[model samples]
Target chain A: MNQTDAFHRRIDEALHNAQLRQNFRSALTGIMARRAEQFPDETQLQALRDQARAVRANALVRQPELLERLEAKLTENGIQVHWAEGPDEANAIIHGILERAGAKTVVKGKSMVSEETGLNHYLEHHGIEVIESDLGEYIIQLAEEPPSHIVAPAIHKNRREVAELFQRFHPEIPYTEDIDQLTQSARVVLRDRFANADAGISGVNFAVAETGTLCLVENEGNGRLSTTAPRVHVAITGIEKVVERLSDVPPLLEILTKSATGQPITTYFNMISRPRQPGELDGPEAVHLVLLDNGRSRIRVDDELLDTLRCIRCGACINHCPVYVQLGGHAYGTVYPGPIGIALEPQRIGIHKVGTLTSACTLCGACGEVCPVRIPLPKLINRLRAEAVDGLRAGTAVRGHGSMRKPAEAGVWLLWRWLYTAPSRYRLFTRLATRLRWMTPPWLGAWTRYRCAPRPAQRTLHELAREEGFRNE
Target chain B: MSDSRERILARLRANRPIEVPTPTVYAKPLGWDREHCIASFMQRMQAVRGEVHRIARDAWVDWLAGELPARGIHHLLAGNGDVGDRLASALPASIRLSRYDHPIEQWKPALFNDIDAAITHARAGLAESGSIVLWPDANEPRLMSLAPPIHIALLDSHKLHENFAAMIAAEHWANGMPTNALLISGPSKTADIEQTLAYGIHGPKQLITLLLD
Candidate 1:
């Protein structure tokens, strides 16, 4: 879909649904409030952010070495490590694993990687019965929709609707409005499936290269069950999810939990090195780690764009984002959403295709402030805009921008072309745009919906300081 | 199979390039306070619908008995400790009491929802976030701290730490890198459906932490 069309359609539908808006508002408020009380001071959070970023940076810096060590260690521990270079290869490797296992039933934990690979649709097409064991995931699975929120998959749902949805599956059950009763019902149902599942699919929260251990964090015990109850446990993780060492984890955990859910630490943290050995009562007998490159190696080589890889998918940026709050996740038209999604989906799919996704941001810097790894999401969005502009000039026609040749549009295009073609023209355009602040028409106002163009200053700060003879001072 | 811990500690702790963490300075208005910090933490939990109370150490057992019947609680699967035993003794003769000493799968259902409530003693409480950290042991199979619908935790006031950093340091001292550690703030909650605040979506619906004097 065209990015603008996708954004408009999803946002319109989501806005009409009062319940989802309330869910998102309530969840974001709860997380923000708890985080505020927990830290009360911004300094601590910033420190945590720095440390977590460093941990990931260290891991990525030693990617080749760590990947080799991780594969070797995992294989020694009776776990198969498969390297997948792209989406097709990743999906094929996973499907091959299931086919060889002859897996009829698969219980899944909340794995964003699976969403990235569209694993469930692929597996189901192969005749495997896949059940999303996570309560939120299960709700969406029943509704036949994608997750609108990362942390809370069914954030777009309401209790009354969920109660009605439950009724479809179990008619005999009473129409209980109580949340506990509904959760209990889900627990009972998923527990039975977990006990009998032929294979369990999971996503890695963090993979420790030093020990070849994969960490799964959850508030509910379902993740543990998903990884342990089935004979085979399959983890689909992106190549960038790896951390260099175990010690690098504590600081990351501290930031991840607080940033994700305002918790000091999640309820259950399972670090699995290998499947259970002979005579062990629990844990999968066979373990497989699918290392998916899927555009990450290409992303890493781009120095300006590489910061997006530092994201932990904590959803902090989304929760804090004003635009995301109003539009919701579906508007992003991709697996990831919010500020990070704005930067990532464009890169993953195509910048020209997802141009509107990047343009829809407020540039409030809230996403950057809350980011655990400090990805500078707003800056990335701006860079994506520049890329989209370049892509359009390269004659790779996108849907909306391709057709937008109005006088104003053509004028802006011609201006950028001249600016790039001549530095003096660029300086003159910048000065002219700076002086024309009052002339921004309503259509331009739409482009600046979430942000002001910062009423362009009378003079550049550097130029003003130079004129004031304050260079030395 | 290699223990990931041994390898991690070896790599990060040995031949490590240590970058000292710079001191954090917050504005005076945001300076920390012990009581206010603790109360703020409790307020966060309360905002999510979890309850908090403070009682004299000697009155906890009696308090549990009085609160249990009002909530229609009967069967109890409690952590093994001096306080848990006292609470278990207060239950009616007809209400079954199971003392946890090891990981038992059959007891999960009873702990999760079949029972009225489960009471356990927490390792410590962090005042900064109003969070209670649980250390897994033979008597606490990790699930006991979570599976139950109603979690009634006992915390001696002395066990409370001023902040998360203090709590983390304390934990490192008590247990050498916990196999599993849980830092529970309040009850289980979600805002999944239509953004409505839903309590007890997965974890405990009601988390009652009684800070014992």
Candidate 2:
């Protein structure tokens, strides 16, 4: 099947699965409620949003400069930094570091960027064992599934499913469907891996340019153990994660946790300035930071589209998105899912790749409204829709911009343009539509498949006006 | 610089976005009096299942001696400092207090398996978020706040700041920062399982803050 067919099949499967739909509904309802609670005052919310948007905008505008400053500071702090132009290069760089360190076992914190690089598969293929330490990540890893949500990776699995997963994976432990017991099993299982792992990998929440510090946010202490317990700590992040100063971190951090999981702050906000210094008792002895630039700089070049880089990966847009609530993240079949996913995936992989994702939006404007950084998600998705067919304005077109444009569709649009622009053609067309209302088809396309297409009225508005003795004509 | 770094930097520079003004600082000192800040801090902390005690600074050791046994905590892992020594001298013989003096490599198994709880010193606390900040050093390792199933943190009342940004400015973190700094709000938790709030998944399951007044 083609990409579009595959996407539709996934959506169909998700919609038909009552379990998945109910899971998403309950999860999102709780998230939306807690998020609202966190931001009780609209005035404060707007002010924080403005502050966060400004901070991200400032970072994007000066991205190149801030990145350089960050590199310099990290180097000064004794962190070894590497840059990768794409996923393969990034994986190779990480592998090379592991090879030098003789690291066979790796524990990872939840990092979306690592998923973008397909890091786990790459390492496993090279005979390395990489364990995901986050409880949600651990659950999904055991099930051999991709994360179904950004903040809550295994949000698709209810408690019974999780207990079953634990029993299936760790058969030695007695089976229990209790939530606390299920969590305890994962803790016991991953704790050993963390304690003995040769290296730890995590994603950066924000890279502070002013202090050369890498900040990671997590409610689970897995992030801390993954970064600290292992002898070598490797952090991988996209180039856009940098902020200009120390002060910029607070507003961004504050909004991120609240937006992502509706927590005032995650349980742990870790700031790593460097590897374990010479005198420090424990931390990673060697710290390596890899900056991946997989088509981000290209996206940043477009003035209006540059807003895509403003995301803090809060997953708030996903929670509020109406279309997303119907189908979980897996239905999108991309690394990112939901408002940000549809908007961003097509950009990373050419529009020809996932451009069909643009069809999966209602544009109800909820995602844009809830975005803490004020990213115009609807506008960007709408732009992508146009870009998918007609292509963006002149030289600014995205990859495979006109690939989805069909000759039949284009012809219909052209005819529509012709008929709508001319007064005589429009009047004639409307007269025919009104007189032939009985002939209107019950089905036109997939849109009409769910609901009846509107049939023309018995008389045109002008005819009614003429009957009423009003004559603008 | 590596070739990839140079190339990536070149691409970013070539694709430089339009200039935007630097942001005006939005995080401000809450301006709450000490009493209000303390109350707010206690409330926020407790909301997330954290235990807090407003005890006099000198009396914290005695309070822990009384409280740790009540919780049935026996093996206490503590940093090799004033608090560790005090716990050693003051606590009854029933509770075994282990000092984190040697390198972690020497006792990884014990740290992961044997220790029941740990006590770490907090650099500051934030009332806005009910977070206790820790900057681990040679005396207090990074894992002190992370590894053990139960963690007890000691914070001075004066270190409570209105918010994270205010604390950063007051600490002048940009001047010099430790290898690892953390803001721990409560015990490690996860609601990933059907949105069920399960505490102490990977990090400390219980976080008790003995606020020194």
Candidate 3:
């Protein structure tokens, strides 16, 4: 099946599944309420968000210069920085580093960049063992499923499912449904991996240009262990993560944590500037940073879409999104799902490939209002929708999902527009519809699939007004 | 790779958006006094399930001596720094202490499996977020606080700052940064499984702060 058809089927399945809907509804509601409670002082939060927006905007404008400066500073600090034009190059660079280190087993912290590159699959295909150390990532890795949510990868799964998964994968350990017991089992299993792994891989949250520091935030200590336990550490990030100064981090960090999980701060916030210094007790001896472009450079130039790059991946937009709440992330059928995903996936992959995803928004503006950096998510999604329509009409193959326009649908829209443009035709059509209201056809299946078809108003509002005016005369 | 780098950089440069100045709205201090800052730090730390003990500068050793045994910390890891050395010396003879003088590369399995707790000095504390900044170096390694089951951070009250941004700007952190700097708020935790909170997944489960006045 094509991408659009598959996307539709996923949505259909998700909508039909009552359990999935309930899970997302409860999870999103709690997250949204907690986020609301955290920011009691709305005025101060708005002011801070404005500042964050400007910071991201300014950094994006000087992205190239700041990137070069970051590279130079990181090089001086003894970090090997590699630039990749796309995911292929990124994987190759990381694989080469692991190969040089003779790393047989590798532990990974939760990194969306790695997911974007499909790094785990690539490495496993090459016969390298990669273990996800984060609790959520580990669960999904065990289930052999992609992450359903950005911050909480396995938010869809309840404790019972996890217990069963653990029991299946770890036959040696006795099965238990307790959350704490499950966590302990994972720790016991991953601890050995951390101790024996030859290399570690992590994603960079914010890369400070002036000091060449890669700041990573996490609640689990897995990130710290992933970077520190092994001899070789490889950090991958998008080119847009670089900030001009170390000082730029505070505001970003403040909003990122609060917006993400309503936490005042994550447990561990690490700033890695270099590899292990001489005489140092522990840390990676060789640290390599791979900066992946992967179509971000193209996004940097688009005027309407440039702000999409300013996202910090906090998942607030995901939680607050109405469509996302109803359908869940799996329905989007993209690595990055939700409001940000609808706007971004099309650009990163192509507009035509994710055509169904582009239409997966109510444009309620909830995501924009809750965004820490105040990215206009609804506006960007609208632009993608417009691009998809234009691409279809022009017979041009758009990037990502490709063109998904039907000539019949276009003709129907054109006929409706022609009738609506003239008052006489519009009135005649309304009158005819009112006369044969119950004759609505079943072929208009998309509209009436989940909802009742609306009959034309008994009389157009314009007709009622005119009749009222004549009676007054 | 160089060609890729140049091409990427050139694309970014060509497509750079209209520049705007970075806002200074968040640069102001949080207006917390010394006592208030300490209180806030303690409150914030406790909220995240971290233990905070405020003691006189001379009373830390006595407090640790009593608390360590009570908490069943048998084997404690200490760095080679003066503060670590002093604290380790002050511990009772009954308590076994190990100084982290060698690189962890030499004994990865033993260090992770054997150590009950690790002691390290925090450079500063942020009152707004209740975080202790640790700039671990050759003397005190990064894993001193991470690998063990329990992490005890010794912090001086005088070093407490209002928030992270103010601390960074005032400390001139942009000039020079250590290989690894950390801002630890509490013990390692996760709510990943159905949003159920659990502590000590891969890092320390307990974070105890010795706030010295």
lDDT of each: 0.71, 0.91, 0.88
lDDT of 3 at B175: 86
TM-score of chain B of 1: 0.77
**What lDDT tens digits, residue by residue, belong to model 2 across residues B1-213?**
679888878877887677788899766666899998899899999999999999997999899888889989899998988889888888978899998998899899889999999998998999989999998999999888888889999999999999999988887888888888899999999998888898879999899999999
Better of 1 and 3 by TM-score: 3
- Higher-lDDT candidate of 2 and 3: 2
lDDT string for model 1 (A357-419, tens) is 876787889989888888989898887776665524543212223332246666877877878
Task: List model 1 lDDT by residue over B14-55, tens digit each.
Answer: 332233243232112335565665676677557656588878
Query: In model 1 chain A, where is the ten-residue run with the lowest total lDDT?
Result: A396-405
Candidate 2 runs further than 4 Å off = A391-393, A466-473
lDDT per residue as tens, model 2, A194-313: 899999999999999999999999988899999999999999999999998988999999999888888999999999998987767789999999999988988898899999999999
lDDT of 3: 0.88
Q: What DockQ does predicted model 2 obtain? A: 0.83
Point to the candidate with the largest TM-score.
Answer: 2
> Docking quality tier of candidate 1?
incorrect
Q: Output the TM-score of candidate 3.
A: 0.96
TM-score of each predicted structure versus truth: 0.71, 0.98, 0.96
Per-residue lDDT tens digits of candidate 3, residues A74-136?
A: 999999999999888899989999998999999999999898899999999888999999999
